[model samples]
Target chain A: MNLQVSRFQFFSIVLNFIIYSSILMAPGITVINAKQDGWLSMLLALGVGLAANFLYLMLFKKHGYPSLFELMDRSAGKWIGTALNIVIVFYALHLTAMVVRNLSNFMITDVSPYSSPYIYQILILLVVAYTSYHGVKNLFLISELFTPFISLFVIGSLIVIIKHFKIIELKPFFYNPPSAILEGAYSTLGFPFIEIMLAGAFLTYVKRKDKLVSIALSAIAIGGAVLVITVILVIGNDSAYIVARESYPTYSVMRDVSLTTTFKRVEIIIGIAWIIGLFFKISTCFCVAMMGIKHLSKSKTFRGYIVPCAILVWAMSNGLHKTFIDFTNFVSMDWTLYWFTLYSFVIITMLIGLARKRA
Target chain B: MQDWKTTMKANKTTREKIVLAIVWGFSLYYIIGYLAGIDPFPITVWLKAIYGPIYHTLFGG
Candidate 1:
């Protein structure tokens, strides 16, 4: 199968992957942890996230196509390699389930309280399954087309609400305890950022392997800036207390914007951009999981596994949490450590492979 | 019965066939269960069933 994607398409995929669900929810977690210094926390997290990306790039340079799975195989023999592959596949599926659940919860809580969560759950899973069946080329084709509109609407919303931004909301910047900033950084690093580990699964398919590092770095930097600006805007407009209290601070801040006396409730723009971004996000995560399954099982075709995988993701999404609070608490408290542990495993495996190459 | 069993064995590797059967079988079972409005087995059951004792022994969670 021709899975090759261009530099621009790959960039769009990575950018959409980072911003999709994070824009809606990350600011709240940042504010809750770092208070007025939430932007700084994101900055710190971005630096750490970039360093992780550098590690991925190093692995890619050494072991080109097939990415992390190949690196694991080279680092360890067949038995251990297959075992690690299973673990990586599980992690990808878990992350995909979390994303699916996050979007489902957003719709239930903010968009439609009366609707059954299963409706959105099945609908999204069907869409994701269909996209994954067609493979990465078609997936990122939609990403490349929709990415512009998502970016335009996001930037437009920021401009519309530009006047409401207040300096006072960020006054006590350094006042947060060191632990708060560190926790916030850790959480941000785990989410939306280090989660680019999913993108590593696709790096092999990039037609211009030479541009991989630059493109990935640029995407991360752009995504980080958008996140920082989002934090600033959310805290600036609504105050850190309001941003922290709200379930979706970025969306809530957009809700408060009014372009003119006659115009109101412009948060709808934010919703439109976010929903579009999430389509690509969910698709990317599902694709990564599909890739993992193919590699682990040595399957010639991924299509056969798509339906079963989507069903498993849907089941996990539904069964995982009873309420949104539990979900967010998991994200803030445990998710970072869980995510970093998996990432560190991959990096360690790669480092071992690199050392052996030299030896 | 002997002919059918011979044919099945000739068509695929045992591992491939087993994986296929598991995938399709579990998928169909889950679909039927979902349509019938059967709640999924509680997530915590497995988490606790498996991880609970591990955590208790390792970190005493």
Candidate 2:
């Protein structure tokens, strides 16, 4: 009801959304498409993501504190607003399911062949549903608590992997075709970055309306930069072919960790960080889905829908597609063009329309 | 004024009780079981019944 989250809490939420799934897989995917120039495409993707964030901020400024639902109502009228909300809600749920299935597949393939993928999905969904049911305040608190530990693990992993870095591995920077680099940028842009469109749903909760733009922009910049650096490190250290072949390249990089016989098998440490960050990402998406349902139902209490919604989400993940490749292909070609472009246009148009009306 | 105060107090207490029950139930059912090494069979079955077919169809077991 208060509709105002603290700056740090806001940062934690955005960071959580930006950190998972993509960070683990983007470098590998990028190298597959962009070869030795994968890091360059990643940087380009970050810039594109930042530009998209700016456009979102422009819209937020014009609307003051209106949530995405409210903004849609004001801009498009009731019938259109309701339809758009349905579209976005279904999209949000689909993306949430995609992330869950993707992470489950990664765990099965990269972490442990013993555990069933269903086990990982249910466990992750339970954690996400529990956190989301408590509402955003609890979600923020949990993220803040895990933030320090995740940060330390990421930093420690980078440090541990630094000794294995070979300068010669980065020698052939332009080996990949130019078209491939462009295609990789397009794909990466669709993922972890452009997907920031989902953040607009949560941004309305930030208390300091005046600082929202600065905070959101800074989060994107910092998150994207962290991702780009990780990509560079992954590409610089591993052969492009090896990097491209792995499902979870960064996790594989962690597997390569052998620091003077003391810090071997650091994949577990990376696994812990991945689990925590992935939980936050799934939880944030689940929260948005809950909010979308509340807006649709015009209900004040969102907690009632959590169980049914979680069940539906688990079922929907099964219905969507199979394999990580199908999921990746959807994100790259379909989701990037349709969901990303549509929301970007709608938000930008709403911002301009609101601004003109105010004038 | 007295009636308003009484109603407000009642609502506040009800909300607090609900929150407590939820927190306690979630911790006991989810976190505690996870910590105590309980196999998450029921939840996995529910998920598998939903997702297994998709993977099976797409990847072809």
Looking at model 2, the pairs that clash are: none
lDDT of 2 by residue, A24-46 (tens): 88888788778878888888888
Kindly report which residue stretches of model 2 are placed more than 4 angstroms away from their true locations once superposed: A260-262, A348-352, A355-359, B1-61
lDDT of 1 by residue, A225-336 (tens): 8999888888889998888899988887887778888888888888878877877888887888777767766766678789888888887786566678877867766666
Could you give candidate 1's per-residue lDDT for residues B1-61 as a string of tens digits?
9999897558656666666676667656665665566745554444445544543453223
DockQ of model 1, rounded to 2 decimals: 0.23
Instruction: Report lDDT per candidate.
Output: 0.80, 0.73
* Model 1 lDDT, residue A125, Cα: 85
> Would you list the clashing residue pairs of candidate 1?
none
